[model samples]
Target: MVSSVNNPAIAMAEKPPSLEKEPMADVEVGIAVTDEKDDRPGEGFGEVSDLKRGLKQRHIQMIALAGTIGTGLFLSSGKAIARGGPVGTVIAYTVVGLLVSTIVFAIAELSALVPLSGGIIRPAEYFFDPALGFAQGWNTTYATAMLLPSEMVACAVIIRYWTEQVNNAVWITILGFLLLVSNMFFVGVYGELEFICAILKILLVVGSVIMGIVVDLGGGPKGHRLGFQYWKNPGPFVQYLGISGSWGQFLGFWRVMGSAVYSFSNVENISVAAAETENPRRNIPKAAKRVFVRVLLFYITSMFVVSLVVASNDPGLSKSAGDASASPFVLAASSSGIHVVPSIINAVVLTSAWSAGNSAMLGGSRVLYGLAREGHAPKIFTRTSRFGIPYVAVLSIGLFMVLGYMTLEDSASTVFDWFQDLVSAATYVHWIIIAIVYLRFYYGCKKQNISRDELPWKSPFQPYATWVALVSFTILLLTGGYTVFLHGEWDAETFVSNYFNIPLIFALYFGYKVFRKTKMVSLEEMPIRRFIEIYQDNPEPPEEPKKGWRKLNILW
Candidate 1:
């Protein structure tokens, strides 16, 4: 018997052990029927997780802010402009941003209620099916494992801007070591580091936007008041692939969708560490509700500013330097005769790369730990140190950081790029899975006669928002490599990278089902009411009123 002090749900005397043990059974369909008469708090959907809750509300907010602002925004937004013109780029970002907002809300609702690790994966098992949970869990872990080396390689590339005398392998080694060490500490340490990096990134983006506006108004030494001149000349859209008229413009706009998705890849990471968060029911929702604002200020507005100062036709935007030279902000400043901008942008982008790697390490390890807890992964990954750090999982994921050395070789570097593309496609599939799981959670609540208001927190724009995101992301996934299908444009790498993950996910799902015979969790058996009882029994303390300086710290 479990103590009520540790878990209030176990205090219910009338509850049967079968209700608690069934969902975790491996061989047969586990049906967890809630006892309507026994209103006492029930044990949460699963076993009591052991991960420590060291992340505060501020840490949650900062992680959400910093996680998504990485190389995609700092370096690849330029590629978006070159592929799609200013108008097209902005539109694609806005559309994807809105859709991504829905995803954030969907996950937030589930995370607030479940408050578990593994982002949507844990909830996927409870609300959808164990097979889906197994599939997406591994998919996320694989993508995040690949992400570490990719970001480390980007760091090595950025360092070359300062001095190529040092071997790329040296920088890769240094960055990988720092990331591994950082994730091995307590969760607070990682949160504090990300908090500081997020502030720096926010400052750089705000400063760049202000600088862009000044340059557009002829405030720079160039003295050319460039008010929307690029828009007029490039004519709002590019004629992609030498095609003419609206069709070409449409293709260009469609192409930007992938880049936009990549730019916003990890925005939903706010809840990935839900079990390690303080007052998660409140903080996760707080961080999630602000996603649209962050998307507008950091992404859409910055892309709009880039459009004003940098022309879509600028050759610099197409440069393959893979450093600050390829950033549109750097291009704008250089064109305006501001020489110091390259070093400044390079410096911040380097930190962004490192920060991204650190985030990947944390997210990957936690997902692996969650898999272990669910019996999907080896039990060794479940080991944790005295600090409540999953050191074994962290070490396992850190081993992949060695992949950064692949960049030292020419042919291996090309292979690394293919892996990066595969990760990008996998990101879309992850979002699609989130939507599916949330929809199931939504209908499960309805099927069991649970009210949205009864949840710990409810996200606005319910079933409609999720439905739209589902259809749109599905279309984007199918057409991700459409160019390869066109005449005279058959690149095996692009075709494979874009479409390979589809079959791979299906195989994982079916393989797990065939081996384990796990069935789709029926709505009636979902532990929604049990989870609600836990939420009601264990109430988090109300936030204290802010006074003076504390009130001013609203950035979180």
Candidate 2:
């Protein structure tokens, strides 16, 4: 189970030993991750639970919102509209939503049962194909590589609203620094900050939806209810899924899908956080059950309302090509004849970007630590601050923030665009792995004689749903690139962008296998129970590190 802000929760199953309660003065410098093998935090990335479960309901509230909101919806929504038109896009979203929900439910059930820090990806090694785990873990990390910049660029762009007088790159630099600094402090602070920003993100999206609804309902300027005027006026669906959708349009949805993919990059955060929650068995199940509700009520509901209020035919819809300027949410607010609302929305959306960047940094860092703990990465990444924060991983992951800012360079948009496309395309590859993993999970349950009653939460439509998800996801990705072909504006960029996903997936799998000579850990060799037993030995957490400037001594 891993959460990422500085590094989203990267919780793995393991045990604890008594923490060193050194004086506060001695603990401030930072903790150096040693090769200690007593099954503590650094016992080869054993697990993370250094802090208290002080997060309130609001924290969970924002985490879910932050997970779903941000650059994806605000910026990517318009692209979906342009491609799918009103009808096709609407249908696509609904379909994707349901399938994703099903996967989430399955993830929830397994996570509640396993409660591992590595989340679904780690468990893939156990429940599903071990090869599936390698794929998921590696791709998840690489996806973050692409996604981190996507978010930071959006954040930089959003900041432009406050002061257009300033050059965009300046904003990128500032925003990048802001997020990097946050990560340096540690996961707890990162979590708290993300908690606040996530809440704001939700409020902004939810509030905007309510506003658009009220205005559309004849509550705004001149009693002119916007209603679904555009929907009907344009004839239900403006674009057709076939010839009506066009190549350019349909490919556009892939971009939006990329953003949506990012929103859920760490969807299994609760599983990671479970290892750190005050009470694992109790808190985890509750969070798992609630995750579905949060997704529907927040993400789908907000997107649905916004799509309704603003007709897909609107010119603003066309411009959104998913660039910050193209965000339909901001444009629609502007169109409503509400001036301040647009700026306010922009400000909040800025939070979404910054918050997302925060999540990226947090998640990526833990990934580094996880890999290091597994002996897949360098030992340096295992070092932690005196406060139990993984310092090296934090800094290593933060390096990407600087590179993320480079994408903001105007001259680099093409390169950035390609990078973005490549990143988004990774989604199809990822979901495929997830599907594969789930498929394996089903058989693993049966082969291992694990019963439904033993499951903490059981996904409905199993076996069947797993097949449906895998098949549909494959079709969507296969057809996705065809949209570009249909547009007749096809080029290397289009083809490579759309097709590279498959190769990238293999590259990671084979590349790592060759280097590590890694083989799939099969059912008999799976270490799930071994990991759980280790943590069971020492239950009491180490005392909090003392707070001081020079006294920082990180326990690596």
Candidate 3:
């Protein structure tokens, strides 16, 4: 039942409402049923979402898979192997993967209960402080804006691998135009394209792993077995910065943690467009539960295979080609005298870059729309086309594509590296905010004597998992620029890139807090019960069982 008291603090100032006492006859399911006369778009759930619920179960699953399996894994893993060696690289990725699993569970629990746009940003306002909501909303927007241009620049570099005669500007412009056009139409258009791209990426990753095994077993044209020879010769860890000792090996492992963060950057974006997803309470949790398995299967397994087939000291791993030539899989295949791997890996990696840009565009625009809904941004961003596309928000973020032109003057490879560091730092900040918001939500439940069984979905390791993630992400963020502190290793660009987001988020948080005078919502007054009531009232239909050929399809 929609409570007559819109303000949870006022409703619970005296005592928590008994479930039996609340009326349910007139309560509408799924959407808010408030009596207030606010006509603003998305002011409350009562009016129904103006955005189309065109995303199906498969679309949500593929988007979750597509967002994380991009240029981070395709192109950047080479750098990780170079700096950390085989064993160190695996350790870094494994640690980050476990932390990311906890984040997925925390967000899944929250998004399952209150599946709103802007992902965790909307919940931050109701469960924690409104100022926090504003800060994270803009933090995500800024990060996504920077990400789009980075992907566009990557697309240009990928094109140069085939031929250098064509100017990089030409590829950037073409790719930028395609990205803008794809997001301007109905969201289903974007979903379908992502579905196709995700399938291609899955195939490529699996194919590369199998090929790596073949090369390692002396099944290649060269007939040379390379079973852990690199690890034995070069050792299990790198002596980073010409330092020679166990300490240097440890630093090498720690350094790869940042690169690991970049590889796993957008794994939490699965629920960003919750309002546009059909039966999100069911679909979101399903996707979240499967994410851990996907990470292990697609990421860790690939890294293990790459380590076995390719040496850590391969000169091509550090090449500035910014294309398939630098991919560890491509390098391994070429060394084994296999001629077909480069062209195939290059084709898929190119699409992966473009797909990453498309995802950033969609995510950034929806976040802007959610910010406008909560009055954190200008109202103009709330405007949508008749097709339910957020046109104004799309155009606002699309303008950032112009940043890709910087590659024309400077080296494309250099520009791509700059964006990699900057975006990775921003991603750490984003994950930190998610952990904080989840902790607040978890405590809010406890303070009110609400049972975890009552929630739509309760994650496995509450409070504890989130706590570990919070501390680990903070350390990573602070040490992201540690190389600059070493003797004769200072780089102004590196320091600024790693540390800039720290101050930017603080300024946004306190600025909004002081100006708006928004107070933190007390734990006792959190709206957990109200959202629980909504979930109970809205019962989704049972999923149909798969049959015939569909039964074989388990990827989703």
Query: Which clashing pairs does model 3 show?
Result: 32-45
Superposing every Cα of model 3 onto the true structure, what RMSD results? Answer: 4.3
User: Candidate 1, residues 2-119: lDDT per residue as tens digits?
Assistant: 2322221222212433434223321111112222223222223332235677888888998887667877888889978998999999999999999999999999999998787788
Least well predicted 10-residue stretch by lDDT in candidate 3: 23-32
Task: Return the candidate ranking by TM-score, descending.
Answer: 3, 1, 2
Models 1 onward score TM values of 0.92, 0.79, 0.93
The top-ranked prediction according to TM-score is: 3
Q: What residue runs in model 3 are displaced by over 4 Å at the alpha carbon?
A: 1-48
Task: List the candidates ranked by lDDT, beginning with the highest.
Answer: 3, 1, 2
Model 1, which residues run further than 4 Å from truth? 1-49, 409-420
Candidate 1: the clashing residue pairs are: 9-42
At residue 411, what lDDT does model 1 achieve? 44
Q: For residue 302, what is the lDDT in candidate 1?
A: 95
Off by over 4 Å in 2: 1-46, 49-58, 127-132, 240-265, 272-274, 320-325, 408-420, 514-518, 523-556
